[model samples]
Target: MKILVFMKQVPDTAAPISVKDNQVDASKIDKYAASPYDEYALEQALQIKDKAADTKITLVTLGPARVREMIMQGLAMGADDAVIIKHEPAKHGELVEPNDLDGLAVANVLAAAAKKIGYDLIYTGTKGVDDDQGWVGIAMGELLGLPLVAGARSTEVSGGTARVLRDVEGGKEKLEVSLPALITSSQATEPRYPTLKGIMGAKRKPVLEWDIASLGVAADALASRVERVALDMPPGRQAGRLLLGEPNDQVQELVRLLREQAKVI
Candidate 1:
């Protein structure tokens, strides 16, 4: 079986963040190994590969050269190979610069890259923590003509089909799908860390590169522009007042303020 995992590089959460010129100042951010949500997708892929050692699991990502670091992490976690769509770095942001791709455009590029791979199953993070747009997998599935299952907590593959369990707002639901479907994983599932040997082995695994021209996508497909923007931090919230007094006094004062002064009850 051939499986594909879509991955992405994001600003490390621990790094100090600031909004400048309406773009994230990521130059000084200390990059983490991989995204937490995508880690669940990787873990699910590894688990699938573990059961069937013959399974070929590959990864795909989009970003600057530093993004390959994330692909390497997936390799270390036991994905057999990888493909990285390298985006040119810019002073502001990729969205503000060339290949002006939003989350949907990025998804378009990914769909183009995976179009010919003929993967039996595709795995992805339910949502990117950085963007939180939750469009990539759905967009790819739409472009590729495959069924989509989001918030997947567990999955099973058999006879060229998949049985998935997805976590909804209040509970969970099950879906049985044929092969060649897309599934987005969430924290309802657990991801595995790489073993030392797996890390060393990943160094020699294949890492392929692709671009717009090779992927046969038009400049228009990635054509998107910027508009209204905000370049500063939101005003910090003021501390709340602490009502300290006799129980009855505090209640009376609170009620009066809510009803007469604040006009909110």
Candidate 2:
């Protein structure tokens, strides 16, 4: 079996972010890591490889050259090889920023690459950390004409079918999808870290780099559908207030506050 996992590099959520001139000041950011949710997707693929020794796992990422750091991490985690869809402005015209592209555009590019590199199944994070727009995986499935299981917390493949468990309104729903399907991974097991041996081996793994044009994706398809007006930090939180008095008075005051100032009631 062959599995293709779509991963991305995103700014570390813990890092302090600042906005300048209506855009995120990239200079203020320092740390970057694999999107947390994508790690979950990679973990799922690695677990499958653990069971099926013959399975081949490949990591696919679309971004600038810096994304190689994230790719190396995935390779260290057990992906057999990797493909980097290089988004260089100088080489690929003006459409090079992966983060700037809308979900549909990004999906189109990835779907095209997926077609070039065959796969029996595809895995992706439910949403990216930076945008939190959970559209790429679903959009890819639509573009590829493949069945998709979204928010899959657990999955098992057998006899050309994949059984997926996903979260529903209050509980979980189990679904069985045929092969050549896409699954958007949610929370399942904790993602594993690369060990010393795995890290060393990752240095030698094969990495195939390709430009968007090589995938035959039209330049117009990469156009942004949405426009960003500005970026700003959220307002700071307010301090809490105390209602001091007898128990009954405090309860009454709390009710009054809820009904008046808080207005929650």
Q: What's the TM for model 2?
A: 0.91
RMSD of each: 3.0, 3.0
Q: Per-residue error at 79 for model 2, in Å?
A: 0.5
Please identify model 1 stretches exceeding 4 Å from their true place. Answer: 93-100, 225-228, 231-234, 244-247, 254-265
lDDT of 1 by residue, 6-101 (tens): 987777778776665676666556664566778888888777777888899989888778777788778887898999887875545433332236
Clash counts per candidate, in order, are 0, 0
Q: Compare the candidates by lDDT and give the number of the best one.
A: 2
For candidate 1, the per-residue lDDT at 68 reads 77
